[model samples]
Target: MPTSSPIPANEFERVLDLIELDLDYTAQHESFEDLVKLAARVAGTEISLLNLIDSFTQWTISRHGMDMEQMPREDTVCQFTIMESDFLEVKNLMLDERFREKSYVAGDAALRYYFGVPLKTPNGYSIGALCMLDRVEHTLTPEKVELLKIIADEIVARLIMVQAINNLKYDLNEAKEVKKRVAHDIRGPIGGIIGLAQLISQRGEKNKLDDVLQFIKLIQKSGTSLLELADEILNTDVKSIQAAPELTEHELNLLVFKDKLEKLYLPQAKNKSISFLVNINPENGVVPFPKNKLLQITGNLISNAMKFTPVNGKVTVDLDLELKDNAKNLHIVVRDTGVGLDVPKMEAILNGTAASTDGTSGEQGYGFGLPLVKHLVDGLNGTLTVQSALGQGAIFDIKLPFN
Candidate 1:
């Protein structure tokens, strides 16, 4: 039997690897504000940190009510707290010999009432600590410690999810890069070969023009397939990054949706003889949103509709605003007269594995569109539901609360 190796001495180094591993995930925070806020809230502390211990520094992935991003590890009391492999709540560090002299407790990022919960990775390694601190000492009730532990668990879950998504993204990127390198380099030569073949076939005896056109069409089709592959490969990275900006109130109008979605998928829809239109109820509303995210969600729907609908079929989009007791919500519906899916297929859509059909003109694509759409919608705290009939049409209902 193989013996297990000792755990890495540097937790920060380990977590740095974790962060890197999670960078490609959709849940990977572009910033760690949520974690910081959660830490502070759970511990009821004036300051909190999602701190990772490095070789020489205590790096703060997130800090509530603090400006510092890092501090010397030598000065970090949280470092000592994390090494314990258990939850710690020091009501007053000055009275505690272990941390009283620590500069993090005695000096900067000053600590009085200190609480830290180790953030463990899936393999039972402590990657970091979620710490809450106050400048003044106060007694910590057991309930507070339990709450802090819960928050730490939340942080761990978030980080793990980020890591998982990052892994998927990594695999996707690797596949994409390999495919691109193979296809891009081959496209030029393939095009030249097909072009030359067409020329030779055209110059041959009568009635060979059709054969040449068929060969050229096949080459062009292959080129188009490469283009689609390239788009999916790149979008796997661009679309998957959880870079949605903090929510802000914005004016979302028909024109905005049109300029964003209609302009995006209109050409594709037109090529399929699919008519796309937008209908806005109360055409204008102030709903809090991350504009880029909203755009991404709608783009998925519009594009999906365009891809699935029949030639001359209409894809209708409408936004309805509801204000109840000052709590506002936007109801968005996308109705398409297309080759509507059955119940099992709709469940597949929810599971993010539904296979997509070609557009009216046999437009080809992979099946990632709706999966990404569902993910973006969920990220916005929205609910998405689908209704469809096999031959009649499909309806997508998305309801989102304003930020």
Candidate 2:
């Protein structure tokens, strides 16, 4: 008598994980169910199942006549069937010494026959088996077994193709989301610039030299913003943005930060007739931070301030280095004298539930800016605080550790 050998627990687990079968094991595939039906017909059996063996169980990914979706690994004949590379057929469960004591044989189902072909991947892992079962003793011809093996191959091929299709769809959806975000972020600055340009053109002969200069500066700022927007879009890999590179030494520079901020936001404030101030005090020579992420944070805050603040209102940005607990931390504060937010509104904004509203000048808001800023802030291992009151003003404080 041939004894059935049990697979080692650790190796079984490793193979199961490597197969990645759990992803689709519970999913309904009409084609796969049809395959099970065809398998049962070809083997002249009363029941059929496409079973994937997990660490401790046999999961019926697809089935034709089985009422149960799963069974204990010890109780499943598929377990031993998966051990071999080819088809396994038990002539009669009552006659087979290894399976005669099994519960299914002695229970209500009264199983009497079994035939299964291993579903093997190209990488040589037998993930599971396509099996047929019968309640009466039966025999399978050599030709039938060969046909069963071919069907098993077709089943494996279908599963692989379905998984590939799913992955491709995921990637496409991700790219669309990234494109939508980029368009939304760029729209605000572009719209502001267009509005300012139209205003300049309408003023024509009445436009003063100083006013024209400010408009030009604002337009220049918008163009620079577009460039920065392009940089962010180009550098972004939607699939891997979550694991973006950390702040690196070669990428950090205090001078570039000061220059970019002044160029980007000062004109925006001027166009809005808002008093804009920036103070940078870097005690260290090198400012170690993710430059693009910092730009996104500052750009969103300053843009919001410019949009909300009325004429003659003020916006101030302060950046300094602090020594706390023997570590150098960067401190940033952006305060605005604008129509501030109520507690609920503030909470909603921070929690990404707030709808965007028109600015003081009727400029449209993207509503994603603050949420994106918060995401980037958290990515940098920083903290953000918002302080505001209706009809008063708003302030944003950020703290990031450098060392």
Candidate 3:
């Protein structure tokens, strides 16, 4: 019944993927196990289930009125339910050819008025079903079928959200691993750069002094960029940012940001032969974000642009304001004319695979950029979207709550 191939054994990733199954439903969440109980009670049914179909079995992830944990794939009502596109209702299983001889339906208890809605993964993989069963023959009106889909949608959303959180945690761990290796490996070369630069500066002939100094400058620039990349990894925790002394409500400091960015990035950007254009929102009016948090998020976006984009490519940043109903928000977008993403990176992010990217010019990476952006956005109840067309460019858009 699974729409996609059974999750590969290696990809099952039980440590991070199955958090909800391992944790009790505290006050914060009503677990799927609880939803099963509620469903059976509401319909006055003999059984209900939140089940996931594996390669060879229909496993009841959570059960209320049923003792069976799973059944062979061929015996599953879920398999038949999956054959249809939407919620299904068989008011009387015994009367139909499909169910008349099915052992589970004809066994110790009768099953009638059966309804189930399929649950799909965020990336469009069909994973399982939420179903309710009753013993008495009955008809489900169109409205009831609609209601079942609505409830099923809620179930899908909660589970997918749980899975998304799990995937983010995986990304954070992978980023950390990349960070550790990068720090351990880069020190010797960085030290050699500084030492060689010093040797050349102190004793090189005047005619060659300019070349030596230029080499020193490039080393310094590379070292600084590497340091900033490491800093981005360490700053993933949003709570580490100091709260603004006073939350200012005025036009944002464009000149201050420009100055700060130039000081932080001029050498690295120049090394890459990249040009940066930072523009403020027309409204420019600021809200209540802690300035350091804003800087970390946007600065990492810029850092990635400089790191991965090809030489001489242009990276432009823009901001806009959105007022929806009673709330205001900020939409900041950074786009680069770079060597864009390939199919693999896009699919990997969508399917929650490992995170890593090599920089152009063989600059290498610590692999923390977008993951850090995503974590900070999650902390603030915001949104981040990454768009890229192979051979074209990449654009990142982040939405932050304003007021």
Candidate 4:
């Protein structure tokens, strides 16, 4: 009895690295089609394949004289080909103990000849194979074997280039997200200064010297905070930006939180001629939670609401502190009157698969806001739900437990 190749110790890591390549399953395979065809023509074989063997499936990335896309790894002769240091060649698969009972050999296809070279990565992982096959037995000359090996190297080089391109694209996206996050984070303090300036102007002659001095102090404080936040966000590394924010407990003062929220969004609403309301129940007290993450979640929600809401529309953010089952729970509701969401869009937002789209005022949204909110909520052991229909507006509800 012939035994199958032993499973590689780094199988899981190999699969993860393969996924990191972000291999395009659509038109990318066409790039390898020519290579496979060339292999078949050189070896005088009827079939040729560029195969990538992962843990569960043997993906035929490119094929000639065959219509297969993928199949179970357990049922693939190329699986053994990947395990070989040089190459595996069976002039007659029917006479080979290891491959004789395979479906392609004993069954309808009746493939006899096989010659394959392992597709090895730079990191020394044998991920797949480039193989040529035929119905009748045939021998591959030394020159043809060397030619096949050279073709396999070309294929591996192409794969490496694809992976590098994908990695560059991913890094670019991450950088964009970092900029969006910084813009979102700085809004509160910057808006505080603008709102405070407006307040000072409104108080004109009636403003006391003491009040004016206090406002100036507030402006200075907000400016300092904004500078700090800008520095931190701008200096964040790509790896840090890609990672989820840690859930760390801190004291959350509800009144201060509400005031900050008002300062952040009220002026924008006023400029847009929209109604913005911040209502907080039991707006005083300190609770333990991840303050920054909660702010991120709520800020994203409210900013999105205001962005989509039209002039004269209403956008309200309500924060309710409730005691249920001897535990403290915070409920946040952001309701907006705007062009609403369809089922597919809503599902996509929650699933983090939504694409960036233009807002009502032609404002470009990051498309990642709601998804990041969902992620933050989940990280904090919270529940988030949404209800909306097209032309009916949207309501986002979030509930977080504070023990």
TM-score of each: 0.43, 0.56, 0.38, 0.50
Best by TM-score: 2
Which of 1 and 2 is the better model by lDDT?
2
Query: How do the candidates rank by TM-score, highest first?
Result: 2, 4, 1, 3
List candidate 1 stretches off by more than 4 Å: 1-30, 104-110, 196-403
Tens digits of lDDT, candidate 3, 153-248: 777787766656655765665465565556665676577777777777677575385777677677888788777856765664322212222323
Give the number of the best model, judged by lDDT: 4
lDDT of 1 by residue, 33-93 (tens): 7767876876667988787653233556667877655554445666666666778778887
Q: Rank the candidates by lDDT, best first.
A: 4, 2, 1, 3
Cα error, residue 306 of model 2, in Å, equals 60
Clash list (residue pairs), candidate 3: none
Off by over 4 Å in 2: 1-5, 8-24, 29-31, 237-403
Candidate 2 C-alpha lDDT tens digits along 1-403: 4343456334433343334431433345475877888889999999999987643346676888877566545567887887886778888898888788777887888999899898887767777789999898778888888888989999989888776776666556657657777777889898989999999999999999999999999999998989898887788653223222333322344555666677656666776688988877856434444343565567668777777899999998888766544355777899999999999888886775666676787654445557656766776788888999998989999888754
Cα lDDT of model 4 by residue, 230-258, tens digit: 78766755222233333222335566567
Q: What is the lDDT of candidate 1?
A: 0.64
How far is 4's C-alpha from truth in model 3 (Å)?
21
The C-alpha lDDT values of all candidates are 0.64, 0.72, 0.61, 0.75
